[model samples]
Target: MLQKTIHKSVACSGIGLHSGKKVRLVLRPAGENTGILFALQNGSGRRFLTPRPESVIATGLATTLGQGGDSLATVEHLMAAVRGLGIDNILVDVEGGEIPIMDGSAASFVYLLRMAGERTLSARRKVYRVTKPVEFKREGKLIRAEPCDGFHVDYTIEFPHPLIGRQSLAMQVTPQSFTAMLAKARTFGFLREVEYLRKNGLALGGSLDNAVVLDDYGVVNTEGLRFSDEFVRHKILDFVGDMAVLDAPLWGSFTVFASGHALNNAFLRHLWVNADEYLEEVSLGLEPVAGLEAEPGMVTASAAVLA
Candidate 1:
C-alpha cells in the first residue's frame, strides 16, 4: 500500500483530561517517511518529537509521550485514529501539554481526520511484521503476539462489577471495523475512583459527559452504555492506540488479557529490544528510492512551520 497523509489542515479545541484547561490541536499533512511527528508548543518554542516505545514516559490514567522537558498526555485516542485510518505520515501540533479527551473516545479524532481528507503519497508503506511468537506477562496481565497478514487483536477484560464481568472482543483492525466497532466506545471508571482521582488532582476534566461512570450497582450516566460490550471494545481501542507508538505499523495477531497501558508499553519495549529476532521490516511495492524528492512538495508551508 502507498503512504498516506492528510490533504489539508484541520483544527479542534477542547479541555484537557488531566489539566482541565483548554487546549488546541492541529493536524497537517506530512512528507512520506516522516511518520507521526509531534510539534509541541511550549514556553521556549516549538519542539519536535517522534513516538517510540522508550519515549513513553507515563501510563497512569493514559499514555504520555515525553522528550527533553516537554510531554504530551492522553495521546492514545488520537494515535489510534491515525493508525486505524492507515495514515502513514502526519504532523500533530499541540498548544497544550495534553491532547483533548474528546468524549473519552476516538470518534472525534476520526471525524477530524475525515474532514482533513486523505492524500496518497508516492512512497511505499513500510511495516514491521512479527517473525516469531512472543509473550510478555506482568503480574496477572499478559500480551501475546505473532505473525499476521494484518493487524488483529483479541482482547479480554475482567472486572467484578455486575455490568462488566468478563468481556472479550476479537477483530481485524481496519478503517471500517475501527470506526464502526471501536471508535465510539468511551473510557470508563468507577464512581469512587473518580472521586479519589479528583481529590488527588487528577481526572480534573472528567465527567459523565466524557466517560461512562459506574457505581456499586450500575452505570451512573443516564444515557447508559454505548454497546452491551462497550468496556471490552474500549479496551481494544486502547490496545490499538498503544501499539501505534512503534515507528511504523506493526502487523501481528495479538492476544491480550487484562493488559492496560503499563503492560502494553512494557510488551512493546520488549519487542523493540529484540527486534532483529522477532521483527522483519517489509516495504510494500518495492519502489525505487532515488530521485523521489524531485516531486512536488508534499507538506504545505503552514505544516513546514509547525514541523
Candidate 2:
C-alpha cells in the first residue's frame, strides 16, 4: 500500500463553532511522509503544527490542539475526515483559530477531500500497530484496545435522555464504511447545555443547523435524526479523530464505553507513554494486494486500515 495525498488544492469558508466568526480552510496536496501539517495563520506569521497526543491542550466542546500560544479548536471532525478517507499526507491551512463546524459532522470535509481528489505516492504507508492489549479507564468511562489486522471499533454511548438512552455500533473502519456510515453522523448536545455554553461565552456558533440539539424530551432539529443510531456513529467518528493525534495511523480493535473527548485523549496519552509495551511501528509494503489494481474509489481492505 502506497501513501496518498490530495491531487489539488481545495478551499472552503464557514463559521467557527466556538469563535462564531468566519474561518477559511485550505487543503493542499503534500509530498509523502508529510503526514497532516497545519499552517496556522496569525498576526506574526504562519506557524506549523503537527498533531500529537500532548498537543491537545483542551477538550471542552471540542478537541483543541495547541503549541506555545497558538491553538486550534474544533478540529476533530476535519481530522476524522482526513484520516477516514485514507489520506496519508496533506497541508491544512487555517485562517481562524477554530475549524468550521460544518453541520457538526465530517460529511462536508469528506466532500471537500473528494473534490480535491486523491493521488498515490511512491512511499509505502507506515502504521503503529498494537502489539499487546491495553485498557485505560477513568471513572466509568473506558477504552480497551487489542491487536488487530485492521482498525476496528466497538463503541457504546449512554445518555440519560429519552431520545438517546443507549446506542452502540461496531465496524471495521475503511474508506467505504467510514464514508457511507460515519461521515454523516452529526455531533449532538442538550438544550440546557447549549444555553450554558452560550452564557459562558462558548459554542457561540453552535445551533440546530450545525449540531443535533435535544431538549428535555426529544430532538429540537426539524430534520429529526439522520440515523436511528447517529449518536453512537458520531462517537465512533470522534474516536477516529482522537486517535489520529498519533504520528502514524493506529491499527487495533478498540472497545470504547461512554468515553468522551477527555477520556479518549487520556487513553491515547497512556498508550503513547507506554508505547514500548503496546505498539510496534510497521511499514505496509509498496505493492497493492495481489490481483487487485490500485484505483480511485477501490475498497481494498487488504491495504492497512487508516485511523
Candidate 3:
C-alpha cells in the first residue's frame, strides 16, 4: 500500500480536558515519510515531536508526550483519529499544551480529517508485523498479540459499576469500522471521580458534554449511551490511539483484557525492546491484494487506516 497524507489543511479550537483552557489545533498535509509530526507552537517558535513509547511521560488524566521541556496532553484521541483514518504523513500544530477534548471522542477529529481529504503519496508503506506471539500481563490485565496482515483487536473491559459490567468487542479496524463503530464512543468516568478531580483542580474542562458521567445507579447524562457497550468501544478506541506511539503501523491481532494506557505503553516498550525477536519490518509492493477496492499502487484512506 502506498503512503498517504491529507489533501489540505484544517483547524479547530475547543476546551482542553485538563487545563479547562481554550486550545487551537491545525492539521496540515506533510511530505512522504514525515510520519506524524506535532509542532508545538510556543512564542514565535515551534518545537517538533514525533510520538514514541518512550516519550509518553504521563498517563494519569491523559496520555502526555514530553520531550526536552515541551509537553502535550490528551493526545490519545487525536492520535486514534489519525490511526483510524490511515494518514501516514501530517503536521499537527497545537497552540496550547493539550489537545482539545472534543466530546471526549474521536468523531470531531475524524470529521476534520475527512473534510481535509486524503492524498496518496508515492512511497510504499512500511509496517511492523508481529513475527511471533507475545503476551504482556500485569495483575489481571493482559495484552496478547500475534502476527497478522492487518490490524485487529479483541478487547474486553470490566467495571464494577452496574452501568458497565463486562463488555467485549472484536473487529478488524478499518476506517469504515472506526468511523461507524468507535469514533463516537465517548470516554467515561464515575461521578465520584469527577467530583474528586474537580476538587483537586484536575480535569477542569471535563463535563457530561464531553464524557459519559456515570453515578451509582446509571448514566447521569440525559442523552444516555451512544452504543450499548460504549465503555468497551471507547476502550478499543483508546487501544488504537495508544498503539500509534509506534512510528509505523503495527500489523497484528491483539487480544486485550482490562488494559489501560499504562499497560498499553508498557507492552509497546516491551515490544520495542524485543523487536528483533518478535517483530519484522515489511514494505508492501506495488500490487493490490485480490478483492481489495483500491488500486495496485494505492491504499485508500478507509482500507489502510491502521495498516
Better of 1 and 2 by TM-score: 2
Q: Indicate the worst ten consecutive residues by lDDT in candidate 3.
A: 298-307
TM-score of 1: 0.92
Candidate 3 lDDT at 175 equals: 83
Report the C-alpha lDDT of model 2 over 1-307, residue by residue, as the tens digit: 7789999999999999998999999999999999988999989999999999999999998999999889999889999899898899999999999899989999999999999999999987878888889989889998999987678899999999988899999998888788999999999999999999999998999988999999999999999999999999999999999999976688899999999899999999988998889988777754444443344655443444343
TM-score of every candidate: 0.92, 0.94, 0.94
* Global lDDT scores for all candidate models: 0.89, 0.90, 0.89
Clash-forming residue pairs, model 1: none
Give candidate 1's total backbone clashes: 0
* Over 4 Å off, model 1: 286-307
Instruction: Quote model 3's TM-score.
Output: 0.94
Model 1 lDDT-worst window of ten: 298-307
lDDT of 1 by residue, 1-307 (tens): 5789999999999999999999999999999999999999988999998899999999999999999888999999999999998899999999989999989999999999999999989976778878889989989999999877578899999999999999998888878788999999999999999999999999899999889999998999999999999999999999999999987888889999999999999999999999988888887654332222212333211000011
Worst 10 residues of 2 by lDDT: 286-295
Model 1 Cα displacement at 184 (Å)? 0.4
Please state the error at residue 23 of candidate 1 in Å: 0.4
